[model samples]
Target: MWISRAGWSVLNMLQLIFTLAWTAGLIGVAFVVLLVTRQRRLPLRMAARCWVPGLLWGSGAKLVVRGVDRVDWTRPHVVVANHQSMMDICVLFRAIPVPLQFLLKQELSRLPLVGAYAKAMGMIFVERSSAREATKRMREAAQLVKAGATLCVFPEGTRSHDGEVLPFKSGAFQIALDSGADVVPVAIEGSGKVLSLGGLFRVRPGTITVTIGAPLRTVEIADRQLLAAQARESVVALKREAA
Candidate 1:
């Protein structure tokens, strides 16, 4: 039987409440573990790998992952992906086997538990107000990646409202160049249908497919723009394959 609009609204509200509670509890436990161990990577990875998948499952969303074996697990990568929905984060966390750090806006650093966790886990925050500061942060992030930490970046800068891949920004590609790490393009599909921009509280049961493309070697690429465009094309191709 099809649910009425009002019934669907009620169900969405219940799911939202449960998701919030579940997130809080999981983060709380992870925070405590971090404090006790005084370790960042292991705790953060454990929390993310566990909580994110649980979040998706709690919202009645299934995940189909492809090309995960293409990733070279021995070395770090600058993983770039097209942004679609908030669920993209959960999907990436659940799909990627490596411990991944994010390049996030500085504003997110002000968020409560999430901010604290990000800080403790060595996630880089880009301060857009000052170019100097942002460059320094990016350099630090690149160094981290060089030292064997996989970094995930949404090079489109923001989520896509229309489920289309936006233009790729050069920052992520620059990081790959600076760190001499391979750029891994990832395509995320169907997340927008589950929970889209401006519809966070109206999540619907669905499946999200994540396709990880083979890494793009950036060592000889002098043009960041070209690298970004190439990466974007790879992601677009993967999206088509997923479709």
Candidate 2:
């Protein structure tokens, strides 16, 4: 079901239209919910639940999730996963059962409707322009985790080009340490084949598998790097298990 570049344009444009219209409609619902409930980011989790089914249908990617019982969703968690495609975002939202928040880099926060959705969801946007700004955002994220919020982060920082899991970054592990939350490594396969990095227009229908690993407990600062390495290893292992 892979689409040629020329053949993808019309469908891409149509997807764009659906995305914008759907996002706008959801934003309106989020606004009213916010106005009444006054709960920050409740709108985000709500919107995420609504966004997943559409993306899966539009991409023609059937989802197969595994290891749900591996970690307890009742408690807060720092969920880290490998990034291969933008569809991974929606996939995670669908895979995880709880209301989740994300760690958005500065650039994604400025996307027209997407940014507004993140803002409404009360997602933290990290500014990489300077160490100070990034630290500020990380601190906020840590605080959120400490308050029992489930935050999803792609520790590789960005999507991989060839579906390989990239090297892990320290920020997510640090957040786990700072917040005393367990780190959950999740592996996603087949999403890259569905919608690849910079291959937004060339979508194909396929099955995407999500495997969640056991939670890694946060010990102390001395284990930060070790924890990150272990998380990466777990992700790789989970990817194999999923495959």
Candidate 3:
């Protein structure tokens, strides 16, 4: 199921281009419609419901999410997931059953249209160079969670090239701690295989499993490093289960 035939690579690239083109159009329209209607989060909900599912289907990726019952979807929580491929972004969007925003890299927020779209979606950008600024944004993210917004953070900071579950960074746990919200560890398996051409970022048509583990309580976790370690353990275990 994970194999990517060389013959299909070209088709995958073409499909990726086509799907992205149409998806971007849909997102742009969603934004405009929501802005005109004075709607909040409806655009993101629409993307999750219509655009994302279509994108995944177009890529021929069957997303199977396990442990859905573990999460209390009615409330806000910090979702800390291990990073892999670009497909992991789509997988998380589709897997998490809620209106979500991300803690995106500051660099990504510099992209022309992407930055605009992400900000419109209420996503927060992390400025890695300035610790003070980054912490300020994280506090803002914590406030968002307090206001009942679910946010996702890839604690690994970057994607893993060898599919290894990297040690999670501490920043994600800080959001949970600051917001007084639980930490949900998400393990995404097989995302790398679906985009197997590495930097090419084309879909190879495969199955991706997203495992949402039971929410880890952050009530007494004052140390971000400890919380990060605990979250990493949970993610690693879930990854093993899905694999």
Candidate 4:
């Protein structure tokens, strides 16, 4: 016997609640470990490798990743991706093997435990309203990349409501150019079906395909906007390929 759409929605909501609880518990433990050891690497890695993947599994999302081997694990990269859903974060964390620091909105820095963990992990927070502050934060982020931390940024700045790749923001490209790091373009498809923007507690079991495009060379690119455009094009192409 098959379940009705309403029944399936109820089941999905229950699954999402369970996943959120499990993830919150893990983050709490990770925060404690960060405080005890004064070492953020292990806990951050655990979040990427374990917690994120667990969230996907618990939500019944099958992740298919391609071109992961193409990523140079030894060097820091400006990881740029088209944002679709909140699940895009989980997919990126699970697929990328190297340690990653997110370039998040400054508002996220105010959350209690989660914010504390993010700060400890050296995540870059930008106050977009202030141009000077944003530039300062971007410079700091570039330095972090130079210091061997891959910086992941959703250049779209917000989740796409219609699954279309939005125009790229220049901040991520600027960071890559300033740090002399390559820009790795990533395409995340099918996540919008799982948990789209404005869906809140709504989620569904589905497959997410992550396509990692070839790293764009920043050394030869003199224009940050051009680089951003190129990265967007790569993501758009990869999205088509995923389709």
Please provide, for model 1 over 94-117, each residue's C-alpha lDDT reduced to its tens digit, 9 standing for 90 to 100: 788877788988998998788887
Provide TM-scores for the models. 0.95, 0.92, 0.93, 0.93
For residues 63-103, write the lDDT of model 2, one tens digit per residue.
99999999999999999999988888888988998888899
In the range 181-222, model 3's lDDT, one tens digit per residue, is 999999999988887636566666689999999988898677
The alpha-carbon deviation from the true structure for residue 201 of candidate 2, after best TM-score superposition, in angstroms, is 2.6
lDDT of each: 0.86, 0.84, 0.86, 0.87
Worst 10 residues of 2 by lDDT: 196-205
Q: Give per-model CA RMSD.
A: 1.4, 2.0, 2.1, 1.7
C-alpha positional error of residue 144 in candidate 2 after TM-score superposition, expressed in Å: 0.4
Question: CA shift at 181, candidate 2, in angstroms?
Answer: 0.4
Clashes of each: 0, 0, 0, 0
The model with the greatest lDDT is: 4
As for lDDT, the candidate ahead, 1 or 2, is 1
Worst 10 residues of 3 by lDDT: 196-205
The residue ranges of model 2 lying beyond 4 angstroms of the native Cα positions read 1-5, 40-42, 220-222
